[model samples]
Target: MRMPTRILLGCDFSSAPTKRKNIVVAVGARQAEDAVRLSALHRFSSLDDWSAWLAAQSAWVGGFDLPFGLPRELVETLHWPGQWAALMAHYGQLERSEIRRQFSGFCASRPAGGKFAHRATDGPAGSSPSMKWVNPPVAWMLHAGVPRLLAIGAHFPAHQPIPERTPPRIALEAYPGLLARQLIGRTSYKSDEAGRQTIERRQAREQMLTALLEGRTELGLKLDIDTAQANALVEDGSGDALDAVLCLVQAAWALRHQDTPGPGYGLPPDIDPVEGWILCAKRP
Candidate 1:
């Protein structure tokens, strides 16, 4: 079976997608070996629509800004299944309220400050705990996102890779901040609130755009977008569009460097399946 050459996607996901805060998807591909082509920036106004679209699509590798698993410590303490697939299936069957109640009880027993347990990947990826239900609400995102990936029959390279599937629709747990931080270094680039979208933030976005277009990062591949397109990406003060693009860059990097094997597409070799590592996350 002939695989689809260079197909990639970057998704800036939301747990509860609304019209005011949509999920942004950047569809892209490689062109001329060194150029990354961003074909579209699609905004899904609702989770239902996003899930439907994800299920209907195939033949691309995507970097999703969502946690793939919970901390093993938390799961074991709670006496859930130790296996990855069994745990996910068990987790997928519960209602949101049930999950919240269970996680909340776990936190209540622990001390203040660091109440929740974290996955090994959290430190390097700079990601919130998969069990964190508020603020970023990553728990809800896992509740919404993972089941859909399973339903779509997408291949999570970290979790499972079926060799027989042609033109594989591979999914990797991706965090855009991992790459964006490399360029901007603690600078804020986006705000969901229009009033909070300051000039400095806009400049940060511009800096990121320029960096990607010029191949300034470790990724080595430059964008194939026109000047106008590049400007448009920076103009979105919310940063969702740029985030999707950043994830696309990560996927593109993984695609270009096929030899960086292991489930993580450059992640550590002994990555925990129950606590999956993010793509490009280096071992501590």
Candidate 2:
């Protein structure tokens, strides 16, 4: 039997989206077992706009570049609700300042080199600790992003039950850095600061894009993009578009494994419900 095509989305999210650094979503679909075709790229200048856009989508399987859940150790230590849904609800009510205060206190109590608690997926995925509020500010990403997902009632495999609806809107936590590092190994490929956007970063972006086009990654997927799309990804300098496409590739991998025997969407069978796993991230 032929399977229907599913729209795949890869979001490079921003906690405080603005006209300058808007959220970027790469829209695409799997063309074959080893290839994905980029159809469009959408940008939203505000969190409300992005949330509304996501809510309006009929169906899709997306890999979003945001932490879906906080670390279990952090949650337990803070005595927040241990359940994922309840925890998210509690977290949504707290102001960002309070969150920072608490997380800061938690860090102050811990020893050097281990200030932040980590999720199991963080190590293998090479993701920042969900509790970190600076540098990448993923904690803010979770604050701004997850509530919107819950508001739209998107299905998160293992963490949230699949809806009974005919066409499901699925979301998976994804980190483009994981795939980028696999291809370029710690070479910086992007910088939001214009002064830091050097030719070397552009070269690095090109290198990763070439690897994706050649199907050289372990995910066994190739990216089919036009010259314009390729050039845009490399020239943007922020790498938001490229990161979204990288996430799109991961979403494609998850879609291919959506019917696997253990935990659909290529997630680990033992994935923590309170601390969700990243799609296609290797188990440690």
Candidate 3:
């Protein structure tokens, strides 16, 4: 029997999206066992608009570039609800200011250089702690992103069983930086500030794109894009477009493993319920 074609999505998210910095989503489908075709790129300037778009999709496996859950240690230390659903409920109700205050306090009480609580997957994925509010502001990303996923009732296989639907809408946590690092090895490929979008970063982006097109990465899947799409990914100095494509690739990888035994979707079997795992991240 032939395998079914699966819709794949990669998202480069912004916690507080705006006209200047919108959330970018790359939509594509697997063309073969080792290839993905880029179909379109969608940009959302508001969370509600993005949420609506996600709800309308009937079936897709998305790799979202946002922390899905807070660190287990942080949740326990803050005395938040331990269960995934309840913790998201409590977290979604809080204002951003309160979250910043509480997280700041948590960091201040701990020793420097070891202040942020980490998820088990963070080490292998090289992701920042979800409790961190600044720098990358992933705390805000979690606060904004996870609630939307929950509201949409998407399937999170690592945290729970697949929903009994004809075709499930699946969301997997993804970190684009993890994939980018595999190609560039810490080279900065994008920057939001115009002053920082130097020639070096552009070259790095070009190099990474070349590798993806040439199927040189460890994922063993080649990206198929037209010249226009390729140019757009490189021209957008913010790197949102490229990051979205990276997430799309990860989603493709997850789709390939969806039927595998155990956790399916390349997620670890022992993934934390309250602190979800990043898809495609190696178990540590």
Candidate 4:
């Protein structure tokens, strides 16, 4: 029998226990005539707990909604260590408020045009503004998530502080919204806030789910869910099931390019921990 491909998706992450609420969905893969069969989801509460689960799995792909790197100019201006490890260390030493203050001060000192030093490709990708505190805080996510990925031995690009001895693991930066947008352009499928959920929004989410399964979206990929099952996942309100399905789609996308010569995934050599990769899977 062919071994199953395990896939994980992490959402709403934080560095401390008070901010411990997040969702992790583990997916298992199977082969079918028309599409890939993905198993049910496994949820987790903490990154450390998720790390323990990751150690036990074999081949897998993950979609993490976290930034992989900080802007190099910010690092240079702040006089923090240039290397990834040293930068992470400096970040770890400061409290959240201290870090925010330092970043805000850095922004204040720069000229208006260069107020937020960005990665080279940020403009093309329509990613979050580098200096924004919320709605995709790339800097904070890098500070919070990358160290854990490295500690687990995942292989990311040079800009991350990964240990030399970590496993042959491949880390990809993923944004669930990328796929969600393709399904339903700028529609809100879910919200953690109670007041934001509405019947029309739920119907739109269901349509998005239908589009994913029918391969009607521009993702250039197909999902294996039937209508009934897809509706159930969308109606769950938490978006965990839909998120897991999205991870499965990401895993599928990775599998097609897993055999590329270098990093195995199409990850850039200087993958900013502030950006995400769609990891490639290697054949066993």
Instruction: Highest lDDT: give the candidate number.
Output: 2
Q: CA lDDT of 110 in candidate 3?
A: 92
Model 1: colliding residue pairs: none
**Between the candidate structures 2 and 4, which one is better when assessed by TM-score?**
2
Between prediction 1 and prediction 3, the one with superior lDDT is: 3
> Model 1: runs farther than 4 Å from truth?
4-6, 161-167
> What is the Cα root-mean-square deviation between model 3 and the actual structure?
2.2
For candidate 1, lDDT tens digit of each residue in 1-284?
56555478999999888898989999988876777899888899988898788767757788899988889999998999888778888998999999999999999999898899999999987888999999889998988899888887787767664354433677888899999988898899999999999999999998988888788887678877877778878889899999999999888877776545565366566777889888777778
Better of 1 and 4 by TM-score: 1
**Please, what are the lDDT tens digits per residue for candidate 2 over residues 48-137?**
999899888878999999999988999999999989999999999999999999999999999999999999998899889999999989
lDDT of 3 by residue, 1-284 (tens): 33344579999999999999999999999987999999999999999999999888877899999988888898999999998888888999999999989998998999978989998989999999988888989999989998898888787776665554424578899989989998899999999999999989999999999999988878889999999999999988999999999999999988888877655788776778888889778986
CA lDDT of 239 in candidate 3? 96
Off by over 4 Å in 3: 1-5, 162-167
Clash counts for all predictions: 0, 0, 1, 11
> 14, model 1: CA deviation in Å?
1.1
Candidate RMSDs in order: 1.8, 2.0, 2.2, 5.1
Best TM-score goes to which candidate?
Answer: 2
Give the clashing pairs for model 2. none
Residue-wise C-alpha lDDT for candidate 4, range 22-85, written one tens digit per residue:
5556364534423445555656666677667766666465556555656777778888787766
